[model samples]
Target: MTPLSHIRNFSIVAHIDHGKSTLADRLIQSTNTVAERDMKEQLLDSMDIERERGITIKANTVRIDYTAKDGQAYVLNLIDTPGHVDFAYEVSRSMRAVEGSLLVVDSTQGVEAQTLANVYQAIDADHEIVPVFNKIDLPASDIDRVAEQVEDVIGIDASGAIAVSAKTGEGIVETLEAIVTELPAPKGDPDAPLKAMLVDSWYDPYLGVVVLVRIMDGVLRKGDQIKMMQTGARYGVDRIGVFRPQMQNIDALGPGEIGFITASIKQVRDTRVGDTITHEKKGTDTPLPGFKPAQPVVFCGLFPVDSAEFEDLRDAIDKLALNDASFSFEMETSAALGFGFRCGFLGLLHLEVIRDRIEREYDIELITTAPSVIYHVYLKDGTQMDLHNPADMPDPSTVDHIEEPRIKATILVPDEYLGDVLKLCQDRRGIQLDLTYAGSRAMVVYDLPLNEVVFDFYDRLKSVTKGYASFDYQLEGYREDNLVKMSVLVNEEPVDALSMMVHRDRAEMRGRAMCEKLKELIPRHMFKIPIQAAIGGKVIARETLSALRKDVTAKCYGGDATRKKKLLEKQKAGKKKMRQFGKVDIPQEAFISALKMDG
Candidate 1:
């Protein structure tokens, strides 16, 4: 067994597309964990979606055996974490499992919004942060400028920061040496009761649920009875292993070691992330601290394009949810959408990832409604309720006040595009808090409603800044707002899934735009259809879909004017009857298109 003092647990934290996965590959290769012939690009990222998007959605852990120049062998566990703000919870979980972090920044891009956000997280976790400037091999790399930016933005000492080109394997050995000497060693008692933290888990068809855990104290062995402190679920460990780039079975894992524990667990829900695991008979007096379930912030309705495939969609969601604990779904029915699931996600990217996985992995087409953020409804009766869907909102009169979730957003962009970006934020009801400059880049902070940014804010930000702005945000609690729920009506009938909560001042304008967009999407029917947007009993905006024309007059080409008039009257009568009794067959695409509004 490796001595506790010889083990160093650390993770790599950075912004998206900052070569985090590449750096991880360099570290693995430099240690000779995998043979050169067997090594592949982004070997730590196992998911096809991750590789295709060039982003890490999941946190991956690997143990490396390295022989330092001090003539001592060290067990180095590297937990590679996602860089996107959507997976901030995963980063926090990984931080809890490690003692230090390698804060990576691109030499050309300097410190971005996500990089600052993650550095703050590492600081909050009390982890030792080692600043690393990456991609120095690039032509635009200014190592000194980036090091100064890191110090100015992150308030860290960059004099000792390592500069390395992960792509060329330069300065990799020095990085490893820094990890051994600079980072603190993990400290835990081997004789104490078994206490481990489940940072992540996944469902394995062959081995059941594989739980990735960091052993804090005592030892965990195969066949030992383990119980989850949060759920109180008990199971005998079926296997114990560590990731040497891949799963390698081990007899036991002790304190300071990061490994997997399989206990024939059938469901991923049972093996909760951020939960504590302890020996059934030798459990600790209290479970580990800082355990909380992930809460989804963005929500949308997902329906199979063909209603007949609802069951297939349900099964697919369950299977996917087994691996993604941050994703949540429940059964929901809509007048326009028939039957579907109301799914919740961490953020927009998380929502997109889940949607893509359902379509690609399950081979099922889906119709996703507009995404919304959870709102808090306060009633005059001194009661509070959480509103996940706009359709579930109570009458405006009954609501004394409504509070919407807001976020403290930080954006980093080139100084030249600062005005345009600031204008975009202000248009979205964002209140500018501060603006500072880090060299040629400007860091802008704002307090904006979460719902405002959930849809097309990022895309628009990219457009305005010419893809140079980087954004990061965190929940800043809910605040009271002049909010009202706007409903869409087709032929005088309301569609629940199309309802949206908007500021009262912009409700009429938004409603008008929604109706206009819907008119373009809904196909012409035999009867005239009037699409109206209303709040409560008052209609604010309306659009009409003209009835399809027929060749009723063509048949009477040789007849007199009286015959033509008779045919026209009959056609009008038929259309009237159809309007009274016939239901508007709004196509699935119409609903999706109507709610696809970015502004």
Candidate 2:
């Protein structure tokens, strides 16, 4: 077993596209952790979707052995975490498992909104952070300016910051040397009773559930009976291993070591993230303070395009849930869309990735409803309930008022695009909290409704700023708002899938946009269809989809005018009768398009 003083645990954190993964790859390659022949870009990102999207969806870990200038060998356990706001939960979880963080900043781009958010998380975790400036090979790289911004914005001293180009492998040796000298070693007592923190777990088809753990107090070995303190379940360890970036079996994991263990667990839930693992008989008396469970912020419904694939979708979701603990779902049905599941996600990106995975991995086409945030609905009788779907809203007469979830958003943009960014926020009913200058870029903070931002706010922000703006936000709790559910009707029949909640002041405008979009999307039938958007019983917006017409006079060549007139009259009568009994068949494509309102 390795001594505790020889082990150093740290995580690499930065903004999206700021080279966190590249830096990790360089470190792994420099230490010869993986053979050079097997080297690949983003080696830590094991999923295809992650590589295609150029994002890290899950935090991945690896262990490397490096001999420093002191001529002493050391063990470094590195956790590479996602940089996007949607995966902030993954970053925080990784933070708790390490004692220090390597803050990577893009020298070409001084500072971003996500950079501040992640750096603060490290600070909150009481991590010893070492600043590293990346992309120094680029002509636009400005190391001094970024260091100043880091000091001014994040309040971290950057005087001794290391500058490197992760793309070209510069400054990698210095980076490893700094990790050994600057960062403190993890402290743990190998003789103490077993106390390990379950940092993450996922389902492995061949091996069942594999858990990644950080040994805090004692030794964990193969074939030993262990207990999860939080869930109070016992199991015998089947295998013990460590990631050389490739799984290598090991005999035992001592204190301050990070490794993987298989306990013949049937499900991932049986080994919850952040749970304390201890020996079944002589375990520690006090359990570690595990983090709170992840709370899904956005909600939506996902249904298979082919109703026959509902069972397939269920199987896919079950398999996905075994790997992703943050994603949640429940069975739900819609009048127009048929059977589906109501799913919850951390953010819009999380929802899209899951939908895409189900479609691609499971080979099932899907239709997704409008994404919404949870609401607090209070009744006149002093009772409150949580509202996940607008279609399931309670009667307005019984409800006293509705409180909508709001968010505190931070946006960093160049000075030239600041006006457009502010206007976009104002149009979304945002209240400006503060605005300041960080060098040439403007940082603006706003208190905005979460539902408004959920739709097309991010897209609008990117378009208006020409993709130069970086944004991040967190839930700011709920506030009372004059919100009401807007229902869309086709041929005077309500479509529950398109129903959504909007503020009373902007309901009419939003309703008009929904009606106009639906009119263009829904195909014309034999009868005229009246499309309306209504709040309760009052219609706020209306659009008429004209019926498909046929030439009735074609069959009456050289006949009396009265014959043509009679034919037209008969056709009008038939249309009227058909309108009353007609069942509108909304094609699957239309349902998907209508929900993607570009306005």
Candidate 3:
């Protein structure tokens, strides 16, 4: 076991594509934690999707043994955290378990919005941050400019910041020395009662629940009976191990050490992330302050195309929920689309990832409803409730007003795309809060409705800015707005899944878009099918999908004009009767396609 003074615990935090994972890989390689032949790029990223998307979804940890110039061997525990805003919860949990962070700044990009967002989180956790300039091998890399920007924008000293190329391993030795010398060692008392913070947990098919923890005080043995402070559950540890990029069993873990343990646990839900684990017999009186429960900002229903596969979808979601605490779900039944689950996600990307995982992993075809934001609905009777699904909305008469969630969005884009970015925000009814410049790039902050931003706002932002803009946002609470429930009716029957809450100002345009999209997506019926977008009882937009007409008068063309008129009259009455009783055969694809209201 390593001494407390020789152990350094830190996490790598940066903006997307700022070389966080690559830096971790280079560090591991330099220390020979994994053999040169056994090593691979992004060794920390375990998921295939993560490697393909070039993003870290889960915060991964590894231990490295390094010998410094002073002839002292050091143990480094590094947590590679996700840079995206949606996975901020994962980053925060990882931060709490570590004492310091390596704040990687892209030399060419200077300081982006997500970089600032992540750095603030590290600051909030009271982490001692070591500034590092990454991607220095590129021609555009400017270590001096990035250092100045760090001092100017991040308000941190960068004179001693290490400039390194994580890809080429140019400064890996310097980074390791900085980790051992500059970063503070974790403080813990070995004699105190066992108190380990559960940094993360996931389900393994063979091992059941594999829990990663940081030992704050005392020692944890393989056979110790551990109690989870948050869940009040106890289990006997069967094995204890540390990841040198691969699980290696160890006898015990002491203070300031990060490792994994597998007790005879059943599921990941039982092992709450950030929970304090102590010995059942002799435990600490105080529990560590755990993380705030991750709140899902967006809600949507996911139904299986084949109703028989609903159980498979449920099982897949259950397995996914083990690794992901932020994603949530509940059983729901849609009138149009049978049994399904209503899942909540952090944002649009988070939703898409989960959806893709379920479809790809479990081989289940899914039909996702239009995503909706939680609304605070106040009634005239002085009652209030959260509105998740617009289909469940009460009558507008009893409702006093509806409040929608708002977000404080920050977008960093080049000067060329600044005008388009600003115009996009204005179009979404966003209120400009502040606008400033970070070198050539313009940083624009706006208070925008969360509902507006969730539905294709990111896609639109990327398209308009030509993929040069980086954006981050936080919930700014809720406020009353001119919002109403907009429902789509096909042949006078309301499709519950197609209902949404919209701002009264833009409800007409939104409804019109929906109506037009449905007209194209829904197949033409034998009878004239009327697709109408309505706000309450008032129809805002209408589209008529003309029926496939058969020549009823063609047979009577040679007969008298009166006979032809009679034939037409008979056909008209028959069409009216059929329209009244006809059921619109809306294919499953239509519900999924119409929800893509980029119209």
Candidate 4:
């Protein structure tokens, strides 16, 4: 067995686009963790959607053998964590598996809100932090200023700050040395009862459900009968595997070892993250640290472009849920959307990542409603269900009272946009809680309804402020408020898919902006469509665009019968590309393109 003294465990934490994955790739390559020819960029992010989006959605661990400057062989267990705020809960869970963290900060962008949040999380987890300022080779990078900021914010000594450009392989060796020196070896009871925490798990078609666990105490081996602490279910372990970035099947795993275990457990719910695994015979009271399953912060309805793919969508979601525990779905059918699921997610990016993966990996096409947040409403009998769409909401008369989800939002923006941001927040029913100054930027906190800010608020803020603002939020639960159910109309027909309940204060302005975007996004079909925003059955705003009457006129045949057949065929093909929403058939790109609207 490999001794725990030679092991070093750490994770890379950083903001998005701050070279976290890039540094991980270089580390993996330099230490020969993977072969040179087989080394793919951002190799730790093995999922297709992760690579396409250039983000780490899941925390992955890989072990590498590196020879230190003192000529000692070291076993480095490197964990690559998600950079976005959506996966903060997952980040905290993985932090328990490591003794140290490499806080990767971008020299050009300095410290973002996410960076600060993650640094605090690592510190709170009692992990040693090695600050690394990345992107030093960029022309705009100011390493010295960022170093000072890191020192000031993290309260760490500045002498060990390693500046590197992961893109150019600069200062990588020093970073490696720092890992060996700063990170401590795992300290735990290796001969105690078997105890481990399931950090991540996924279903493999060839091997069944495989769980990735970090052993905290005692030893685990193949053919041992183990019990899940939470479920009390038993399984005889088939094989224990370790990751060298790729799953490496092994005979056993010991304390401080991070690896995978495959049992005959076929059901998805049996293998839960944070569930403790223990030897059934020993029955030691030493249980693994458990973390609460992630609570979803966003919800939306998803359907296919064609109704025939409903089952396909369900299969895709089922397969995705094997790896992503944050995505929750309930069987639902929309009057306009047909059979689909009301899916819940941790945040906006989590929703998008699931959607992208389902489409890309499963090769299924889908159409999704605008993302919504959960709302608490009391019924006549006092029963409550969190409503994701206004259509599902009980009538105001039936609702004895209503409360909307509120979030504690922290935003950091340049001083120039403070006035505009304040106005925008006020329009969204945001009440300022506190404010502070960080250099030229103002750190403003607001308590706002979740429904108000979910629609185009982030995009508008970024646009109005020239992308200089950083926003982070946490759920503060529900609060009593006066809200109105608003429905969107196309040609005087109510669209159940686009309805939402929002604060009454800013409905008019937001309605107008939303209708304008809808007008631009909803395609011109066989007939003209009128986009209208209505509150309580009263039209508040309206917009319209002319129909595409001449779309098929050019293809019409004048005299030849064969030409007429060809024209009809071309028209049918064109119609196949359009998505039918009531009387209007919209193009496939309209839904996505509309999301990028500046307004």
Candidate 5:
């Protein structure tokens, strides 16, 4: 039997930019998980996109050998999880592999909404939580206040909160010691029927599907036949290996150990995270609990400006979804924009990550439409269908009744912005649910439709309150309401390019604002362009912008052939970058700014 003193399993959780990754870096360095000279910065965040975004999207597991002050070596399995709500499912799944978590709190930004959300998730999983106040080195930090908030919210006495600077490597040794003392060792019956959970999986061009799992009940070995509880798919385990944190692999991982497994599985879908894998004949179960994907709360369509990257875009989504099961897409075509996809996401950030990955990672240029949330439309017979796609909506005249998705929104702001914040919420059809004060901060809650809150609300809240407002929303059930679908028309033809749903009461204001923003965004090309907002058959607002009348009209000369070639090459590149909307060639930055809708 292996000794309990040799094992340790834990995760680090915190809000975005709360120094979770930086602290993980310090822990890895102190533990000597990677070599002193050969260590890469943010080593756990090995993905290029993760490093660029400064967020941990995927949960990473690393095995490090740390020597306690008692002079005993321990095997510590450190798991790093994503902090964004978009990857909440991924975070919870990663948490299941560990016995405890380091709840890193920012001293300056005391107890954020996301921090509370994750702490509750940890509590639900029954994992031991250790609070740590990070960024003690920062000038604005108030460690005492943050620790009090943590203790109050978590229902744990955080008087022992470790104050550490992951940047300067101060007080890290004590934090390491706390993990060894405060967190309990993983306890499981290894002699029972073999059972394990698939926590993470990745696809390699040469190795096929590489799965990471935590053995919960029994010992697993090579040549063992395994069945997945979620899919009922069976496979013969080819090999078992324990993590060395880097590339080196070892044989035979035991219970409480974090490691990888290889099987006859070829596709990423076959090896899903949070699915139960058991000894084939010894254990049989169907539909594993805790594996259900979180339903997408927002939907949007994406199309290529060039109309040729349609296949490329589809392939990119497929490749990305291999690692990211949360992002979903379906084929769609518009008369205005040839072929596209209607993609579903958990929230706005989820949509942004997928869109950014497609363009920046896969090298595909895309034109994305405004986002739409699911709307519940009830039939006369009481049958209800959730409408995620705008095309799925029945004609307004044929519809019996329409109900839009609502969210319970909570905003934290300075005391001065309380009045303005209420006015902003009222304008967006928000019903004031509650209002309270904690010290000098104002906390306001509103029940607003998801569709109403998805667009420009974040920016508006920040602008009206001088950037002191922070907001978060949890989806509430749909409510019956009066709303209108607004569309933008170019010339006389309906443009699928510009479409949104607004409440009937505020349709005129929204439509006019959108058209005015579009007029400023659409560039001048070879002909004049007209931007018009229409509701059904009537045009509600119109704006006109002249198109580009002239560009380069110079000819190349043989005497200055190199310079002429350079100029022509530059023009071609410029033309390729500009997207042709009607007769106007709009730059990519214009589309980004239009999405923000902030002049």
Candidate 6:
């Protein structure tokens, strides 16, 4: 094992598209952790979606052996973190496993919303931060300007900041040396009681469940019985290993080291993230300070395209959840969608990632409802209820008031677009908190209702700013609002999955827009179908889809007047009968498409 003084634990944090994964690849390659022939772009991004999108969804941990300029061998454990706000929980877990972070800021983009958010988290954790200006190979790179922004916005020293281009392998050696000299070595006693925090875990077909952990104190090895402090579940360790780009079996993992362990556990829930793992026989009296379990902020229902695939969808979610602890689901039945699951996600990106994964990995096409935020409903009798699905909300008469989740949103945009950006926020019922200038960009902070931004705020923000704005937000707790539950009825039958909790002022406009979108999506039948949006028993908006007509007079081309009249009467009777018995068959796509409307 490497000596304590020669060990360095650090993570790379930055905004999306700031070259985090690329930097990770360059570091791994520089350390010779993986052979040159085996190298790939974005090596740390294991998922195909992550590589295609150029973003890290899950945090990846790797150990590297580096020889500093002093001719001394050093061991560096680098944790690669996701750059999006949706994966902030993953970032927090990664931060806990490391003692320092390399805060990468794009020379062209400067400090973005996510960049500040991540830096604040690292600061709160009291981790050493080494600011680095990345992508200097670009012609538009402004190193000095961004370095100044770092000092001005993040309140960090800019003199020591290193400039590197991960894509071109520029200044990488210097960056590595800086990490060794600047970051503090982790401090822990190897002889102490066992207290390893399980930061990440996944289910393996051959190994059952594989967990990635950081040893806070004591040693872990194969054949030892381990206990999860949170769940109080124990399992015999089958294998202990470290990630040297790939898993390699190790005899033991000591304190201040990061590694993986596989126990004969079948379920992913059995070995959860943020759970403390300890040696059964020599366990510590207290568990390490691990984060609380991640709570989902956004929710939507997922249904298979085919009703018979309901069971397949359930099993797929179970297996997928084993790999993603942030995703959650429960059995949910929709009158329009049939049998499905109500799924919860950390944010919009998380929802999209899981949806994409299900379609790609499971080979199942699905219909997803509009995403909704959780709400708190207070009853007249002083009762409180948490509502995840809008259809589950009690009658307005029984409720004293309703509270909806709010977020402290931050937007970083060029100063030229400040007026338009502020206007957009104001239109969304946002309350401006503060505004500050960071070089050429304006950082605007606001308190906005979560639901208002979940659907299309990002898209609109980009549209209004011409794709120059970056946004990040965190839940700011719940606040009382004039909220009402709106429902969509097709042919006078309510669709539970189409229900939504909307602000009272925007209810009519949103309801009308939803009805119009649904009218276009729902296929016309023999009878006219009425699609209405309602609040309680009152209809707020309505749209009628005319019936599909058939030509009954086509065969009477040369018939007499009397004969033509008789045929017309017969056709009328047939049409009336069909209208009385025909049922509107709403397709799954209609429900999905209708819910996608943004008012």
Which candidate has the top score in TM-score?
2
Candidate 4 C-alpha error for residue 240, in Å: 1.5
TM-score of 1: 0.96
For TM-score, candidate 4 versus 6, the one ahead is: 6
lDDT of each: 0.92, 0.94, 0.92, 0.82, 0.78, 0.89
TM-score of each: 0.96, 0.98, 0.96, 0.88, 0.88, 0.96
Collision pairs in model 4: none
Model 2, range 1-599, lDDT digits (tens) per residue? 88878889999999999999999999999999999999999999998899999999999999999999999999999999999999999999899999999999999987899999999999999999999999999999998899999999999999989999999999999999999999999998989999999999999999999999999999999999999998999999999999999889999999989999998999987888889999999899998889988899999999988999999999999999999999999999998888999999999999989988999999999999999999999999999999999999999999999999999999999999999999889988899999999988999999999998988889989999999999999988999999999999999999999999999999999899989988888889999999999999999999999999988778788858999999999999999999999988888777777776565
> Per-residue CA lDDT of candidate 4, range 1-599, in tens?
56888888899998878888999999988898899989888899888778888889888888888999999998888889998888998788889888999999989988777887888889988998888989888899987777877776557776678988899899999999999998889876888888888888878898888888888889999999999988999999999887888778889888888888888888566788898999999866867668778998878888898899998998888888877777889888876678998899988778878888888888888878867887788888879877776787776778777888899988888899999888888867789999987667788899988876776778777877899888888888888887778888777777777777767776787678778888877867754577898987688889986656444546564777787667667766654454244366556566555444243
Per-residue error for 482 in candidate 2, Å, reads 0.6
lDDT of 6 by residue, 1-599 (tens): 66678999999999989988899999999888999999999898889998888889889999999999999999899999998899999998889888999999999889989999999989888899999999999999998888888889889998999999999899899999999999999888888888898989888899988899988888887898989998999898889999998999998888789999988898888887888888888689787776877889999999998999988999899989888877889999877778999999998899999999999999999998889988989999998998989989997889999999999999999999999999999989999999988877899999999998988899899988999999999888999999999998888888887889888999999999999888888888866888999999999999999977677677777757888788778867876787667677778778767766553
Order of candidate numbers by lDDT, starting with the best:
2, 3, 1, 6, 4, 5
Better of 2 and 6 by lDDT: 2
Off by over 4 Å in 4: 512-532, 542-599
- Higher-TM-score candidate of 2 and 3: 2
Deviation of model 4 at 333, angstroms: 1.6
Pitting candidate 1 against candidate 6, the one with the higher lDDT is 1
Highest-lDDT candidate: 2
lDDT of 1 by residue, 1-599 (tens): 67899999999999998988999999999999999998999999988899999999999999999999989999999999999999999998899999999999999988999999899989988999898889999999998998889888889999999999999999899899999999999988899999999989999899989999999999988889989998999999988999988899999999999999898889998877888999889699788886567889999999988999999999999999999888989999987788999999999899988999999999999999889999999999999999989999987888899999999999999999999999999989999999989989999999999998997899999999889999999889999999999999999889887899999999999999999999989889999999999999999999999999897988676857999999999999999999999888778777767776766
Instruction: Supply the global lDDT for candidate 2.
Output: 0.94
Backbone atom clashes (below 3 Å) for every candidate: 0, 0, 0, 0, 4, 0
Tell me how candidate 3 scores on lDDT. Answer: 0.92
Model 2 regions lying over 4 Å from their true place: none
